[model samples]
Each structure stands twice: as C-alpha cells, then as structure tokens.
Target chain A: MNSASEAQYREQPAKRLRNAAIRRTGSSAFMTLLGKECLELLRSFKLVWVPIVFVVLGIMQPLLSYFMPVLIEKAGNMPEGTVIEMPPPVGSQVLADTLSQFGLMGLLILALAFMGIVSGERNSGASALVLVKPVSHTSYLLSKWVSMMILTWGSLLLGYAAAWYYTWLLIDFVDVGPFMLSYVLFGLWFTFVLTATLLFSTFLRSAAGAAFSSLGVAVLLSMLAGLMPKYMGWSPGALSGLAYQAVTSEVLLPLNSVSWWSIATAVIGIAVLLMGSVVLLKRAPAHD
Target chain B: MTELLQVKGLTKSFGSVHAVKSIDFSIQEGRCVALLGPNGAGKTTTIRMLTGLLAPTSGEVRFHSLARGEDHRSLIGYLPQTPAFHNGMSGMEYVVYSGRLCGLSASDARKRAMELLERVGLASAAKRRVGGYSGGMKQRLGLAQALVHHPKLLVMDEPVSALDPLGRREVLRLLQELKSETTVLFSTHVLHDAEELCDDVVIIRDGEVALQGSLAAIRNEHRRPVIELKLEDAPHAINWAQSFLQKSRTDELRYSWLSEAELQGNRLYMTASHMDVARQGLMEELTEHKVPFSRLEVGYSSLEDLFMKVVSG
Candidate 1:
C-alpha cells in the first residue's frame, strides 16, 4: 500500500501490527493474472459444458460403431428370416473413430469458445484497465493461453478416458501403450489449433474472425495432409493421421522419421504462434 | 514538497491527428491535481500516457524516487473514463485480484480489499457480481481496486462524468475524501468538480496545455470582475440591451472598463477590467435610457470563468 492512503490515515490503530505481519509475500503478477483467468474460465461454464460435450461425443463414438450392423439390419426392409453377417468393429477402430469425432466436433467447440480469449478482453476495455498496471504483457497473454489449454486438455482427457472405458466394456480393449501414444499425438494437434487461435485472437478484433481464421488454418493443414500425406508428412496436420494409426495399432508406434519431423515442427510452430501473439498484443493492448 | 512524477513533452498521435501534443508537467507529492478540459481535449490521452497505458509518440515520463529500472506502473493506480470489470466477478474478488497483481499476498489482498470496499461505500455490494453493479457502483469499485495497492498516485479519467447526478455527487464526495489520503490526478470537463476537489488545475485545449498552476494562484492571476443582468424579456428591454452592447463595443474610452459583453437569450453577461467604472457607467445608462431589468449581480471571476475563457479562446 502507498504510504498515504485510507488504510493508513484511517486505520492507524492497527497499522504497526498489520504492517509487520503483512511483509511482502513475493507473489508475482503472473500468479495473480493466472488466478483471475482460471476464475473466468469456471464462471463462463466452459469448464463444465466443454467436458460434458466431449464426453457425450466420446461415448457416442464407440456405442454407434458397436451397434451399426444391428442398426443396418433392423432398418432395411428384409424378410423375417434374413440374416446380416456383419463383424463387430475392432477396439482400435472404435478408438480411432473417437479420435476423429474429437478432431471435428471438439475442435469446433474449442475454436468457437476460445476465439475471443484475447480479443474480447481488448474489446471490453478489461485489457486497458489491467494492462495499465505493473503486470507484464507476457503474463497477461500467457495466462489466457494457459487457461485455454487447461480447459481444452482437461476436456479431451476426460472424453478420451470415457471412450476408452466404454470401448473396453462393449468392444475389445485397446492396447494401453498404443492408446497413450495416440493421446500425445492427438494432444499435439489440439495444441496447434489452440496456438493458432490465440494468435488470431490477438490479430483480429472480431471474435468470429479469429475463430474462422484459426479453423481455416486447421482445415487447410488437414486437407493438405489428407490429400498428400508423403508431401505434408513433416507438418502438424500429419500428427492427427499418425494419431489414428497409433491408436489402431496393437503395438506401440515405432518412432518413424516423418513422425519425429512432424512432432518437432508442431512444437516449433506452437512456439512461433505464442511469440506472434505476444508481439501482436504488445502493439495494441486494447483497440475498438 | 518533492516532485513525485514528472512528464516531459508527452505526445500521442493517431495517424494525422495528434491526440496529445508535447505536454510537460510534474505532480507534487500529496497534491490533488485536476486535468481540466472540454470533451476531446486529450485529457484521457494524457492520463493514459502517465499510467504507461499509451505509448507516447515523443517525450518521457519519469517517476522520481522510484528504484532504478523499476517499472512505473505499480506506483500509480489508473481508472478509465468508463470503469469496466469482469462481469462474473464479485467486487471483493476484483479488488483482491488487483491487490495481488501489485504483489500482495492472498490474505493481505483479501484484507485490504474488504477495508477499501467499505471506504468506497461498496461494502454492501461486495458479494454481488459486478455485472449487476450500477455505473456509480462500478466507479466506486474501480476506485477500490485502484487503491488496493495503495499507489502513490491515483489517476482517473472522468471518474464521475458518466454517472447520474446522484451517482456523480457520491463519487465526487468519495474523491474529496480520497485526495487527502493519496495524490490524485483526475480529468474532467466539468469545472465544478475540479473547483470542488482539486488543489491544482491544469487546463488543456486542443491537445496542448493552456494553463497550469495552483487553484488559488490560477484563479487570482486570471480573475476579472463580472456583472450579469437578467432582462424582463419585453421587446423594449431587449431592444435597449442590444443597442447598449453595440454602443459599448464602438466607444473605446467611454466603455474602456468593459472588456467584453455577451447576450445569450435574456441574460446579459459583462466582464470588466475596472468594475466600479463600468458599473457606474452602466447604471447611469440604465437610468437615463429607462432600461427595464429583472436581476443584477456583481462578483469576481470564478474558476468557471477562467475555464470558459481558456477553453474557448
């Protein structure tokens, strides 16, 4: 507290004892900003709704795959004596399907929810008020980035765990080692989108614009990788495909040269995206 | 008194238009200074520059007595024209968060937040979400958050300008008490607010400072005697007043004491270099001309007068 303030002028009786007891706690501004961000996430209900949506999506993936053959036989207008010879989906295939569902629907929710992570604060004048304080811009931005990551990663983990559990019950159990490897691969994909989103959030004023731009980048990368896997093998887009392969395989994924290249590029891309966001935010903490 | 903060040639430009132009001023420790200006005169820009919220196009803002290489922001508390808070946050949470940002421990921040909220008269609303707070309540909460760190300098831009009259009065009264506790630098286009609370005033117009000094000194230096008359609104009286102003403007020595005269509606305002001489001449003219009048007043110039003069001229 400043030497002259209401606390001192008005609270003189307790001043000495309080000051001695209130010696600087050495708390950093980053901790304060991070704390505020976490509170905001909880209040926004992103913490609850995002995970719920993921779980529903995750549970549906395995359940639908397991019942597809029965569903088709029941739906078609066949004679009463007719039979359908359909084999149940392999556990790994079910896991791969769950990953695809997360890749599409989960990514959509995350992009929409987090598009305004940086831009909304700027638009609402919150950034102006807080940025004027002694807090560093890096702390201000990194806090947002980290909080978004927490919600995204947490939701993904919960959803994947639910899918794994259901797959083991209704279908064959996926190999644990391969499943964990797939999780890392999928996590890297989510990280890239999150980074792209943060960068776009800083770059664009409209939240929708940020959302679409990042999604556009994701879509473009996915398309490039899907259309020409060999050419785009080192790009982050290939990681999602590698994730499917790892989940479907019975053994742990071999460290292929392309897989190493893809992981390294994705990691470096995340660093570049984060650095880009900080630089963009530095130029204008708040703008209309 | 020591100089707490000094601004040297601070300037800001938005493309071709300059919002603040090369302004210099120093804040004395414990002084409540007013940055008085009309709308769009760059008061907000100046405050933003002082708080390090805006990057000045040119010039420096150096805070004296601070540790070498220390960031200047923690030393000053800033509230914008429209004080905004996270809608989902309670007043206590926001203030405590502000305290923690300034390096207070969790327990200390909470303690300070409670005391400051009570001081700002928002103790009752401490638990309510900020989304439900009124404009005045938000302003008060803004004050509490700003003071949470006990900053040496408290900077605000139009702290009461957005509130209704009742809200305005309440915030103004809070500022009146706060100025005594901390060095306050607030900007307002309303002359009455500056006159009521600030010890010093800096009048600016068109991005440049027009006048700056102690309230009493600035008032004394620029004070001019003024005479005001309210007309009956009758055609004859209106005719007489108009002709009298025309005659006063044309005759140099005969109306030399009257420096300026302006008629807005039925009210006639006159400023005089020598009030006695002008009053005597006006009275004699009124008597001879049988000018009908409703009210007459005589007084020394107010800060409002200087503000009007500086703002317009």
Candidate 2:
C-alpha cells in the first residue's frame, strides 16, 4: 500500500529542483534577512532609542561648551569685575568634541544594544531554525553586519546632523568638506567597533562578555593610538583621531599620508572580522 | 523506493572524545525512519550533523533528489529538539520570513505561511507575538515553517520530548499525518514512539549502531525461546535460584543448555539454546533440590527484553 502511493507521489516530484537551492540570489536573501533583522531591532525598540540617544548626546556637548564659561564664572568667588576673556568657541572644536562624545556614549549604547546580535539568536536556538534552510553563513553574517551598519551609521548621521545644527547656531560656521571628512572617518571607526562586537558575539557564549570584550578592544585601540600616533597611525583606531584632526587643523596634513592607510586598514579589519564571524558561525550554528 | 539521503562513514569527535563513531544509514524516500537511542547515545549529535547545524568530523552526508550538485539543505527541513524563534515577531511573520529565506517569493511565502498556519492550528495565534506562545504552540509553528518550502525530506530531533502529554499526543498525530507526505527522519529515546510511528528503527548505543533494520524484521530476528519462573518468597526457594544462577555462571558444562539466566528477587528469567533439554535439566534439578515455586511460564522474549539485552550486553 505504501509503495503504491510512493510511486504516485513521485509524479509531482519536489517543486524546488535544479538550482532551486541556488536560485535564491544573494541579494534577495540579503534583503530579506536585512529586513527581518531591522524589524527585530525596531520591535525591540533599539532602533528608536539608539538614534534618539545619539541625537541627544550630539546636542548636549555643544550646549555644555556654550554654557561652561558662565557656570564657571558664577561658581567662583572672584573680584567683582574680573572677566575671563572667553572667545566664542570654534564650530570645528565643538564638532570635534561631539565626535569624542560619540566615541564614548555612542560606542557604549551600540555595544550594549548589538552585543546580542548572533549570541542571542544562538542562545534562543533561533539560528538553528533559520540556518537549516539553505542560508549561507556568509549571507547570514553579512545580513547582520548590514543591519548593524544601518543602526550605527543611522545613529551617527542623525547625531552628527544634530551636532552640526547646534554648532552652526551657537558657534561659527564649520567647513562642509572637513565636516564630511570627519563624518566618514568617524563612521569607519564606528564600523570597526560594530564588527568587533559582532565577532565577539559569535565567539563568546555570554552576551556580557562579548559586549565587554569588544568595548575593551575599542578602548584599547583608541588609547594606544592616542599614546603613539606615528607608530599606530595605520591602525583602525587612528581613524577617530584623524577625524578629529581633519576638522581642527587648518590643513588636512596628517590625512595626506596616514589617513588612506588607516581607512584601508579599518575596512580590512571589518572584512576580516566578518569573515571570522562567518567561519565561527559555520562551525557551530546553535551557539554551543 | 529511491534512497533520499545517504549518510556514510559518519563520525564526529570533539577533541579526543567521540560523539558519534563511524556509522552508516540511509533514509528511503516516502518511509518514516526513527533514529532510536537512549540519552547521550549520540542521537542529537547525529541529527544535528544531518541538518547541517554541525559538521561531521570525518564523513559525508549525501542527498539524492531531482536537483543534483546542490547544497543538499534545500531538499530537507529540520526541527531541533527545542524549536527557537524570534519572540518579537508574530507567528505569521516568522513563518513568512522562514519561507522567504528558503527562496520562496513574497506572495508565495505569504500564501504558504497562511496555509500552513491553519494546517498547524495556529491561524488564530498567527498575529500574536511568538513570545506569548506556549511550548506546544511553538512546536506547532516550527512544524509549519519546516513544511512551508515543501522539502523532500523532513528531519526532527526529539520533536515531542519537550511537550506535555496532550501536546505529545497532538504532535504524534501530526507526525503520523506528515510521514505519509514525505520521508520523515526523527531521533527519539522513547521506544514506544518509535514502535508506534516508524517503519524502520536505527538503535544506537554508545556512538555505534546496536541494531538497525525494519521494526518487524528486528522483532522477529531478536525473538528468543525463554522461561519465566516466579518462585515462592521463602528463603529456601530464593537460595535455590541464587545457587542455580551461580552454577550457570561458573560451570558451563553442568548447565550447558542455559545460554543466559538472571535471578531477580524471587523470580528468574532464563533463556536457553535448546528449550527441551534445558527444561528437562531444570525440572530434574528442581525436583532434586525440592524447590518451591508458585508459577512456571514459557513464552517468547519481548522487544523490551531484547532491548535490555542489547543495551546491557
């Protein structure tokens, strides 16, 4: 009885055949996964709050700079007319402070929010289900990276825009070229941190460990570059300092030789990080 | 019937520890096969390897279908022991997302998502977040998503083990229905479940195959001549049984017909190479020793008895 039905059942064959598995173009899968991940970020409220926090952080630094002199003068007991000659701060200086603020608070918020990208799915066994469906590890990891980029870049842009608006209103007008250069360079630095977080997320089972370790790497990179610039000039960490240099310096001299190497190395770092994540994920999909 | 999946020389090792030793098995198209084993018997490990979640340390898994040279995953659907889903997404959305990942177009995925949701009795809960779902509901949703792409082969790991009795029964009923549609391979420790729903059983023990064959064939092949005796609980009767077991163990010539025997409390279960000679020898010894016994029954050994023998020996 079973065999009779089996023969008849063979008539239809499987609907998916002959490149059906290969038929799924990389783009559609990427888009679908990217869309799915974005929705998850939104549903979790990370999408809304991360950027909002960035905007607030961006606005705060300039406002604080504008108000610090008055607060200082009022607080100190001094001769009645002794006025501290406080020239209005430069817009470039205020913007650079804003990027530093992003370097601190922005990385913190992003590290906390995205620390669980792969680990959370793995711990929950959700990846086990999604992974079984012919999805390539490259596609999976790439989709995640793309989504994290959306959040990181989106927050950076909104935050930078907010900072620009305030600096223009409160301080002098900064150059569009320097501002854009600084923005790209800072964005690259943020990308490095995001990739590190994702890599650590895949490597470590504990979400806290992943977040802390990635943040630790970010901090160490930044500090090492700060301590020794010529030696660590090409390191991805130097990109942030270069971004600060781009806006504050009269000419883009440091950027002439060091900037390209730093940008290239940072891009390469993101690529290597993603590749490592894909390899690790391919080795064990269920987070064990 | 055509063979749908071929697993050959399958071995998995974690450093120095072997999780699954060299094993070979094949799943025939349109037949339900159960990979049956006890806990820690490498059942889950084998299922994971089959589903591509874990790479085999040294072996190959081949899938034969209309499409050749494919990644082999497109032809298969898998459900892990515990099905996990994004808690934030609604059931309907999750299923559609799964379908899309499997290469279905947007409309096709949406259509199948709705159809499978109703089929799995999750249509009412389709719009609700998966976080609010019950264990049974999550499992049901897992099945629906697994079936969405019409995979040629379906593999599951302990599908019903995490469910309540009612949920277990419900999933079992669904499995019964699903087995008729596609080749189903699932791992489970429950012998009764394997016996109830599978056409073939592959029993593994300690990372190797203890027994693998059609259920009916194994039942017939392992059936052996047996004798069961429930003696009186008196000391003398117990002593006699113990002495007989000791003699059977130490002196084979004196009890050569007894292939195996064990004494438990006041009862004895014994199997022999020759039933008549063993019975005659036992009766004479019983008469000579003045053994007290309430009942003496003879019957064929059950599958549980075979299972115990295979597992223990």
The model with the greatest DockQ is: 2
- TM-score of candidate 2 to 2 decimals: 0.93
Give lDDT tens digits, candidate 1, residues A1-288: 676786667777665654453333223677778788889889988888999999999999889988888887879788787877887688899989999999999999999999998888889888887887777788888888888889888999899989999999999888889989998899999999889999999999999999999989999998999999989999999999999999987789897999899999999999999998988887888763
**Over the full model, what C-alpha lDDT does candidate 1 score relative to the true structure?**
0.88
* Collision pairs in model 1: A2-B150
Docking class of 2: medium
Interface root-mean-square deviation of model 2 in angstroms is: 0.9
Shift in Å, residue A121, candidate 2: 1.1
Instruction: Report the lDDT tens digits of candidate 2 across residue range A15-121.
Output: 44534536555567778899999999999999999999999999998888888898888887978889788878888999999999999989998999999999999
Residue pairs whose backbone atoms clash in candidate 2: none
Best lDDT among the predictions, by candidate number: 2
True C-alpha contacts between chains kept, each model in order: 0.70, 0.86
The first chain of model 1 has a TM-score of 0.89
| Candidate 1 regions with alpha-carbon error over 4 angstroms | A1-27, A79-82, B67-69, B227-258, B261-270, B276-298
**Native-to-model Cα distance after best TM-score fit, residue B69 in candidate 2, in Å:** 6.7
